[model samples]
Target: MDDTLTSTLELAADWADRFAELTTDERRQLALWLEESPENAAAFARMRRLMSDTALIDAFDKGDAPVQPLAPLPELRAGSSRPARADRRKPMLGRRQAIAAGLAGALALPFAGYWLAGGQTAGSPPPLRFASRVGERRRFTLPDGSGLLLDAASRVAVDFSEGRRHVLLEQGAARFDVRHDPARPFKVRTPHAGMVALGTSFSVDHLAEASELRVFSGRVRLDVADQETRVVPADRWALVHGATVSTGSFDPTTHPDWQSDWLDADAMPLGFAVQRLARYSAAPVRIADPKLASLTFSGRFRLDNPRQSLELIGALFGLRLEKRKDALYLA
Candidate 1:
């Protein structure tokens, strides 16, 4: 480094202390000088670097000598030339004025800027979370190949590590099309139950008062509590609540009609088909009475035209329809 550059570094070692001793006018004059030349900015950056480097050395020094405070000093541009004597001779500012000026320059502007930006207060927005709303369904693929289907009004969070994938279903329902990976098991958590899988397709539902799980393929081990460890086989279903687990053979057709968008109720009750059919229609569709709700019929009905399907359902049940405010109320 040039001799003037080396001298500037030496002065910078006590720059803050020297700055404290200068008069207000001298500090103002130095500010003006810095503003006058691009060289002044470069010199300021170098001086700051020099101060940081010196601080590290000072920290390692043997004596607990109070660090001789750094003082403000004249600027030096990088050159074969030395600093002009006139710049060096400019008088220094005193402690109180220097503190005030430093506070205004270093503290107030940042404080004002943050306040104006509306972020100067105590908190940041709560961390981002994920959820699905009522009557809505959603799908998400994890960083792993495993897929998750969220049922109506559900919330779940995903956390994965090198050894396993875990999901916490805070509420509602979902289905999992778990990818095959023996080293890592896919696990789901609910208030009522826990599901651990070894590569499977399954659905889990948690309503306000009930929870159920259905396995379409492969196997899943459900642990309800210490007294129960139910291993659900392929094509099976289970209803769980508190410490109880009730397992049974899966009805594969239970979800196919809704998934396929074709209402095929084979000898299913007339009121039952009507209730199922109501989901796809915009209009309010219901059986006229509880007695009518149980009447049975079976056939494939087009999901597209709920009116025609309802008419079919009504004729089969010996009921008639009345339209009120865009809804078909059965009688």
Candidate 2:
């Protein structure tokens, strides 16, 4: 990396590290800094993007020594207009500003930018990680010709060892289309569940509440210890939430194609899909009624158009839509 880019990254890291506690003056200074150039703003965005990566965060947490206690969060005043962050998804260990900045510096420049798009070192090795940024999707093919279609803001770590092909879903969602090699088993895992492909294509989502698996073709076996291993075939789905496993079947034809840019909500929670759509919006999109978040909605909604999607959702739910200066609220 050049000197100018390096300097800009350093500045961006400083701001990102202290984002949760920026004073009014600091906020003004940051605005001034961002207004200085477009590159500066982009650099800051990249910083936050990397900060949100769960794999990079895993690496950061592992590298941290003599762990420190986290400070308690300040209470939100009653009747505050700002919505609290969703408990289902959040950047892990994001408060360790010092460690965050230091580790970010220690890692190679453009950690998210270069690595997620297939940057290689002197010798391309195992445990390669690929991630997509917020509101963006990415596709990758391995050396063995296996295809990976990564969902928006998703992260995955791949380890192609001599014995097995392993992929860990650190965060978000991903679809794996395996290149059949009976000699080598293909495994996909999240923090909660594990799967061994039966030479098939399947998708895994690491949501805040649970890990979901939807199989489109062939089969996948849930192969976790002490649990009854079950085979999930085409049009079948499975969910793992805190050691509890649930199974359901759906019509493959009616199920929205995962490859499309639109969201196929098959009885999905409103909050979850809203969280996904919020990435496309600049202002925070919040639900006025907390109870509505858990309401399930099954339909097709376009991802590219957040405004239209919100309007449709509001109409369906019989909620009022109000666009405020601070946020877009569905009441």
Candidate 3:
């Protein structure tokens, strides 16, 4: 191997060692490093795969014991499409094969970058887009010291220029912890409403036909498309739909706690709860009985595992759950 490739592999190994302990700044630096070259990304992927192995993890957890490296990866000739059928069955990994696997991992990084940065290229300029898939949440910092938390199945497009920082919430939900910047106001634009904040912490949920805004701290000005502008203070929320804007009270004790990975619902409709849960659920949850959709549910549910949460909800409501190949039906 060349000196550059060897150095990159060593760096990848170091990152794998500290992957779980890396701070936000360290993660940013790692992202920047991956952006430097395709080789670096490939090397990081190879090391990450190795670190994620069940045997390696178990060994690490068992204490300071040296782990026996598993068999090396399969080999492929230069300009080959893929390994032959016989080679695919082989489990051994040679030194050259290991290096090639690292390169393969690097080649996959660009596709993985979509989920990491909402489709935005790391260390790239704006007009960037970001998205989170089902059963996933992402937290990242903006160039302006602002922090953003994207809920599952959420998407947003960002544009930051000389004078303003603008974001369009395309779908799902997101929380913004804005940094104080008097010169450039932070604005979030939804389908039917717009929000402007000077320095505040707020969350926006833009689901089908409805957009809800909740202010956790500081204040925000809500501008509905055809309604009067309203100032929402801390502990308040506004719901916008079509041409109507309704202001309501916000009780943190009962609202969905995204920060804690819990959904604390108080008399929330079953349909709405299912809708929210669907974002984080791998399988589609369907209500077989239309009337049951209006039933209200109140409780705190974990968001990390949607299937378990659904089972709990089913038990609470005494609802029957039918499992099929494609979806879960509740009645």
Candidate 4:
């Protein structure tokens, strides 16, 4: 019931939101947090459990929180491999008890997804994980007939159950061509503030703490954490750089396709273009400083040769692009 524990719980909740789409640097940071103290690890574990326990929802729906022993989760509506299980059965801190432990404010935070979970709270489908090689791009067809185009070095997980279709872009970028299903909203999740598509065609690119979203076919309802959700008109793009939000319009029909060698960007960040070029490299490509992103690139460039493309980008910004130990760096 101390203030420290409560704050840690809140922090853990935010961390939980990003767990599905952590970048390499984020994973390292999480490891460091877990290593800070046993309490930190325990708090994170409880939040993770809270995310999957539908019994907690049942308790919340009723007038009281769960006070009983850990109960089994209902079978995933259908197409799930097996029933869900809960392991923390004992005298436990239910939501009410958690509130008593000074967690009321944390629960009230602007984490709508934490509460709704895209209608998959009752059951979780067996995850189907997919990843592309550093220089390879791949396409997939979901059970729901939607199409997923993963960019080079990207990874994502798909879950298709009776009521919902969820895609977790763990790292890298992907284009989603979703089939319209009102009953089952097609959503893409990331730890960042935005992402989650519905009946539309769009692409999401993630690097470090920023995310970029480009909509091609349908309008997208954009969510900026702790802010109101805004409607992004079709043929527009949105950017979340730290606390700043930038958006602009583009010719959706002329949007750059990674499949093609050249990408025509109109005032896109230098980091984003480099990230795409790095994907085609034989080794890892990284940016030395986030400040370098301040310089923007606004033209077409050949992507087939990553080395040459990287040099061109570096030269334009007056920064050096170098290779160190088989990894490429642009500063």
lDDT tens digits by residue: candidate 1, 1-331: 3444333334323343345476776556556555655544444433332222222333335333223322344444434133343345435554432332232233222333232122232432121124554444567655466777765446676665447678777666678899888888888877777899867888776643346677888888887756567788778777774566666673676544434456666655565565555545666676556676656787788655677888877777667777877667667
**82 in model 1: Cα distance from truth in Å?**
43
> What lDDT tens digits, residue by residue, belong to model 3 across residues 101-153?
44334334343443222324555443546677787887766657788898998
By TM-score, how accurate is candidate 1?
0.42
Better of 1 and 4 by TM-score: 4
Residue 317, candidate 1: alpha-carbon lDDT: 61
Q: Sorted by lDDT, highest first, which candidate order results?
A: 2, 3, 4, 1
Least lDDT summed over 10 consecutive residues: which range in candidate 4? Answer: 68-77
Tell me the deviation in Å of residue 313 in model 1: 14
- Candidates in order, TM-scores: namely 0.42, 0.57, 0.59, 0.59
Candidate 4 per-residue lDDT over residues 68-137, each given as its tens digit:
3222222222333222444543445445334323222434333323322232333443466667877788
Candidate 4 clashes between residue pairs 3 or more apart in a chain or in different chains: none
Stretch of 10 with least lDDT, candidate 3: 67-76
Q: Rank the models by TM-score, top first.
A: 4, 3, 2, 1
Q: How much is 28 displaced in model 4, in angstroms? A: 52
Candidate 4 global TM-score: 0.59
Residue-level error in angstroms, candidate 4, position 148: 0.8
* List of clashing residue pairs for candidate 3: 42-106, 72-92, 72-93, 73-93, 118-129, 118-130, 118-131
Number of clashes found in candidate 2: 0
